[model samples]
Target: MDVPIKATPKQFYDVFCNKTHYVSNVCPDKVKSVVLQEGNWGTEGSIISWTYAF
Candidate 1:
């Protein structure tokens, strides 16, 4: 599921590498929070969890 946005690769990569910031900025209404549960972002085996409300 890849969707293209009007951002550079670095910008896009930065957002996904830091999901909390991106999710908060883009989907603050639907997503309450984002947490990194394990491993450093941009590294292997990284895990991220999102708290959201419908």
Candidate 2:
């Protein structure tokens, strides 16, 4: 797969803010969810961790 692909600045920013790529990149059988612990809109030093299993 030598396809040349790139993400624009806006695209990169969206991925950073929201894990759009994280969910889409994972397998279809994987489980996913988003927990809101006081800061769902993101903030300074907000932490986001993801776990994948089948």
Candidate 3:
């Protein structure tokens, strides 16, 4: 599954890694919210919970 985008690799990585909480803003219809349940964002062994509108 290869999707081409204007952003560089670092920018794409930053969105999923550092800006996970903002994902809902990008696609509000599909993603309700993303919460950090344990540890910290972008850290090893960390946990994140995602809520979908469906």
Give all TM-scores, in the order shown. 0.55, 0.34, 0.72
**When superposed on Cα atoms, how far off is each prediction in RMSD?**
3.7, 4.7, 2.5
Q: What tens-digit string does per-residue lDDT give for candidate 2 at 1-54?
A: 353437787876776576543543543356364444444545655555555565
Candidate 3 per-residue C-alpha lDDT over 1-54 given as tens digits, one digit per residue, 9 for 90 to 100: 575677889987897988788788777899999999998888878899999986
Name the better of 1 and 2 by lDDT. Answer: 1
**Where is model 3 more than 4 Å wrong at Cα?**
1-6
Worst 10 residues of 1 by lDDT: 18-27
Clashes of each: 0, 0, 0
Q: Which model scores highest in lDDT?
A: 3
Show where candidate 1 strays beyond 4 Å. 1-10, 17-20
Error of 2 at 37 (Å): 1.1
Judged by TM-score relative to the true structure, which candidate is superior, 1 or 3? 3
